[model samples]
Target: MSRIQFDSVTKRYEADILAVDNFNLDIHDGEFLTLVGPSGSGKSTLLRMLAGLEEITEGEIRIGDTPVNRLPPRKRDIAMVFQNYALYPHLSVRDNMAFGLKRSTDLPAEEINERVREAAELMGIEELLDQKPKHLSGGQRQRVATGRAIVRDPAVFLFDEPLSNLDAKLRKHMRTELQRLQQTFETTTIYVTHDQEEAMTMSDRIAILDTGTLQQVGSPREVYNRPKNTFVAQFIGSPSMNMFVSKLDRSGDRPRFVGDIDLPISERQAESIAARSDADQFLLGVRPEHIHVHETSVEESVRAFVDIIEPLGSNDLLYFELESNIDVTSVIGNSIDIGEDEQGDEEEYKVFIEPESIPQRYENSDDPVYLTFDTEYVHVFDPETGENLSLDQRSTPEAQTESATGAGD
Candidate 1:
């Protein structure tokens, strides 16, 4: 298996459109990395560039130490499994698995057959070896395609949304199966998908993309719990994180985020924000799970009208909007300064609150409700840059020591 490198890689189309914009990343040897983002986010384009299906407009890509920007797909020693399975309708599973090895190498018939058999066994499709693609189920066909890649023993494995065509239950099963297979083979794998769940569950590290630019690349824990920017924070979570422009105010010893939404800052949080230049005016982010909604008032709780209640069996999602409905369209679309839009009276800021902390009286009620959340869980971002301010707070030795001491006490 090889460690891949993308050094300032870029792709452009005829109309001066940038499909991928100077992407630079390193995929470690035998690591399972997933490229994930929304539609038209350049994830598939990036994958295709690596697989040699498309040309890089500029820069270089390397497998291990060898630059492969000019290499053909066959010479790259990369095996790809596509979303459609791409199995031959006429060829049996055994032949499909052996085709690449036969054509690419001088392996004898006996060795080729043995390799195919081993691949089928590993994929749990040993019994279906002789069946043609027409006779095989979607999941079975996917297995055969994977088996074909496996027998080749390529330097890297590329998967392009291979589970997109499967049913939900089957997709879940295949996700686990694929993880197990990667673990067994210890092959460097790069998977591209629009599904965040697949990326979160399968990848050792996930690379998040948006509009052709890389947003963040980190482990699931780091990406989900400690996002670097507004996009990462919103995109990585379920129902997404609530983002709103808030005004920061200081009154004597205390500080608070006020205007449409309200959140009080503690001494530690205030100290953290005090270290920043644009801390007084920035975007405020809080996940649904971090919000505590209530019918009864609590300290640091602010009132809002309940917009909706979505029940998710074990838990509930309570959505609320500010009474004033401050418009943050530009702030949400791009990381811009949140100025008071005199005509934005129609826009209401929305926040998702988990109902576990709410009283049953406010279950499905549309009445005014109160919300209380920890200041530690609140993430503050620059109004114009969208960069997380709390990350700076966490990076310092003083902050780390203080946080560690607080946790211990």
Candidate 2:
């Protein structure tokens, strides 16, 4: 497998529209990287550029040490698996797998047969070798397509939402299988998918794209725990992180979070928040698991009304409406027996906000909710720029340490 690099890549379809922005990334050799984003985010366009299927409007794309901007698709030594299993309907699985090799090289019939058999065995589709694509199930047909790529042993494998055609259960199963195949082959893989769950589970590192620009590129935990901006924070989580607008004001000698509820900020946190010159108002971001029903009074707390409770088998998700009209959710243990609504009556339940749960401030709002966060976990961002002030500080040493630790762990 080879390393791929996109140096300031840009794709403009027309005078007014730009499909991909100035994208720059270094995909390591033999690494499994996923390009994840919503549709029209230019993930597919980027993949096509790498595959030599589309022209690069600007910048350079290199495969291994060679610049492939002028090279045809055949010279790129890459195999692509599309969303639709693009197999000849009349050809059997074995024939489909061998077709590429038959056209590319003048291998003897015996050699082609051996290679096809090996690929089929690797993909666990040996039993379906003689079956035509029309007769095989969706999963089986997908395996056949994968087998086609495997036989060629391309330097890079490009997957364009290959699992989108499968049912949910089948898709999950194939995700594991695909990871295993990549590991066994050690081929540099670039997978494009809109499914966040797929990106989170399969990729060694995820590259999040939005509006043709790279939003964030990191391991799943890094992006989820320490988002680079408001967009990344909101996009990465399931229930989504809760954000509230508040004002930063000084009460006597110390800085305090003044809003629907007033709470004192620690000296360290206050200094850090004050360091950002662009921050006039502050936005608070908290995850569902971090907020809980406060049993005792702490330094920071918010009085909120419980709106709805969703009981998951392992945990319960509590949704609350704050005084600012912003909705926040907390995940509580299912073992705790909070009485359910007998007559479907919604009551005002007091939820607690831990001091550590408060996120960094961005801008002030008229109606605000009182919030607090663990100073260490708080993420600060610039409202106008939509850039994370804490990302560079938190991403460098912490990110490297995390990578090493995760490898061992």
Candidate 3:
């Protein structure tokens, strides 16, 4: 296994288009690092540059201590599994698995066969050794392609959306298999994918990019719970985050957020906002899970109308519209208490409530419902720069939570 490093790496196409910009990262030995971003975000381009499939316009890429900018693809000691599987139609599974070993190294036929058998066994495709790619399912073809890379036993593994072709269930299964393989081999891995969920599930660390610029690199929990900026916040979460344009009102004893809607913030959040930035206004961000919908009015709760309700099977998403036109969403438990007289054995049963009977939910102009933002789970961001004001060099989710709840005191 080997650690890989990208030092101020950049890739440019023609005289204008910049694909990857001054990217720098250190992938630890045996680390599974994923490059994730939206389409045309340069994740695939960065992977290609490292694999020697594309040339770097600036900076250097090092595999272990060796700089590979001048090395050929065959000499990079890396194996890549592409999105399309890239399997040869004419070759059988065993031959396809052994193809790289045969051409790249002058190993004896017996040794190559042994390696192929081992890789096939490891990938659980030993039974399909003689089958051609045409006869295999998409998942099976994916395994064959991965087994081809495994037989090489390279120091590093590069996967470019290797499971993109498989169905959702198969993709999830393959994700588990890939993680297992990484643990078993402990080879350094760099995966490139546009799928944020896949990246979050598979990577030891995720490197997120946007428009060819590196955004954030952290563990899944770190990026999800304590994003450094608004872009990372909205991009990583499902249903995204609700951002409100607000001005800080410090005239009162306790500062509050006002503009799109009126809201209360913890004293600590207010202090952090004041100390970290000089702007008159900032954006308040709240994730769907952090917003609470109440059947009755509560302190600091704003009255809203239930614009829409989305029943996700596991959870129900409640969309609320404030009088000020701010759109807010809350994720609530789908399981509701069925009355004792109901047919169900259990007191609680999961079911989608009809739009008409959302527990006497608010109509556009009828009964008013209330929504409250969980201040401890909220984020304050610079409206201009989009940087999280609560973040410092040593701050983390726990720290932010402590500050918000006055536990730090």
> What C-alpha root-mean-square deviation, in Å, does candidate 2 show against the real structure?
9.2
Question: Quick one: ranking by TM-score, best first?
Answer: 1, 3, 2
lDDT tens digits, residues 1-409, model 2? Answer: 3999888899999775888988888889999999988778899999999999999999999999999999999889999899997999888888899988988888999999999999999889999998889998898989999889889999999999999999999999999999999999899999999888899899998888877877778888888887766667766766566555555786569777665335566676666667764466555555666555543445677755445455554555555666653222122122211112234222222233343232322112233334345545555555555555555555678675544312200
* lDDT assessment of candidate 2: 0.73
- Screening candidate 3 with a backbone cut-off below 3 angstroms (N, C-alpha, C), the clashing residue pairs are none
Residue 403 in candidate 2 has what lDDT?
40
lDDT of the structure predicted as candidate 3: 0.78
- For model 1, the superposed segments whose C-alpha errors exceed 4 Å read 266-280, 330-366, 396-409
RMSD of 3: 9.3
Alpha-carbon RMSD of each model: 5.9, 9.2, 9.3
Badly placed stretches (over 4 Å) of model 2 are 260-263, 295-298, 326-375, 398-409
Q: What 10-residue stretch in candidate 1 is worst by lDDT?
A: 400-409
Per-residue lDDT for 233-344 in model 1, tens only? Answer: 7677666777667877877667778865687776677666667744446677877777777677787777777765666767777667766745556444353322222353
